[model samples]
Target: MRYVGWTILITFWVALGAALHYTLPQRDVVRIVRVFEERQDLNDWTRIFWSRPDEQSDTFISRDVQFLQTVRANGRPMVYRNEDTGWSWPPYFKFDTSNLFTEAADATSTRAAPEWYVITHYGWRNEFLTIFPNAISLRQVDGPDASKGIPWVNIIILTTIAAIFYAIWVRWRRFRRARIDPTLEEIQDSWEAAGDAVSEKRGRIRRWLDTWKAK
Candidate 1:
């Protein structure tokens, strides 16, 4: 029971540390998208890109076009798309000139823009912030028509889980150490005393010849 208690306490501390260390940026992607929408006033130009009136179906169908318009409206500083040959607009084009942003392409088929597709950008390098400004910059730099999902979703999830376990393991170790029967110093002193007692019983002459006697 005592050992268990110690383990739990140590585990708690370790888990706390790991939890702090392994924090994930809270779903910034959605927040960033919202910010981009608001800053860029995407609603105004959404019609120019889509032209359709319906909400769900139209929005889904026109995502590529709308995204493209947003990038272009933002000064074309930081977005791009994969323009391939085939259906209407492009096939797949990587944008991010700096080579730091990751892109994913979404394929959408329509007569107006055959190659039209949505591209999502993620994993942008911090250095590009000077020019791009926000997450939208990365999307723009890469290309609007590009359709890629955010890159690190799985990695973030795994890292979070690992952090939790790591924290637990660390606390457990700390607890175990705390519960140990004899501390390092105590063990060391006990051994030293035993040696000194043996030497002292040997005789005065032996003690004098010993290292302690010399000191």
Candidate 2:
């Protein structure tokens, strides 16, 4: 039982961490190599990674998705999907897809004259699954090494989650103390009192029988 309890606890935490990691916005300082629009078939399971730009478009299985190709400081290639979240999940409220595409196109640079830009995005890149992270915002930086800016967004999100959990725990403790524990104590006291009353009745019956036997 103890082992099972520990395993469940560990699994819950691992899943929570992975969910936060995938949902939270992260920064990647890289050089934009190219920006292009490609028509992608969104009929399969990978469709969840793409954005829904219009309500009527949900009927279509394929659509054009803007992409930003970049090379990280470590020379690894990274691609980001530029799509408006449009008051959807993650709540980025990004509707300026055209402006973002324009900015990315203008920011394109070669390896020799690398113009570093921080891409603020959320999601995961899995080549096997063909899923790319959705870019939320971007801004030019002085250089690739120039302070990879702090993740204030992630900090705020984590702090809020912690506060929520703390509040839930406090409420649970109060409920247990104020309601659950008191209820259990009352039940226990009633059981003990009933047992004592039964014992007193049994003693009186024994005394009455003993008096009859003596007579």
Per-candidate TM equals 0.27, 0.79
Question: For model 2, what is the alpha-carbon lDDT of residue 188?
Answer: 100
Clashes in each model (backbone N, CA, C under 3 Å)?
38, 0
Error of 2 at 139 (Å): 1.3
TM-score of 1: 0.27
Candidate 2 total steric clashes: 0
User: Residue 103: error of model 1 in Å?
Assistant: 20
Candidate 2's error at 96, in angstroms?
A: 1.1
Once superposed on the true structure, which residue ranges of model 1 sit more than 4 Å away at CA?
1-147, 181-183, 202-215
lDDT of 2 by residue, 1-215 (tens): 99999999999999999989988888999999999999988766777777776685677788888999999999999999999988777788889999999999999999878899999999999999989999988999998787767888889989999999999999999999999999999999999999999999999999999999999
Question: What is candidate 1's lDDT per residue for 84-168, written digit by digit as tens?
Answer: 1122221113233223222222232233333322334322222223111112223222333343455475477668878998999
Against the hidden true structure, what lDDT does model 1 obtain? 0.38
Worst 10 residues of 2 by lDDT: 48-57
Worst 10-residue lDDT window, candidate 1 = 29-38
- How high is the lDDT of residue 100 in model 2? 92
lDDT of candidates 1 onward, in order: 0.38, 0.90
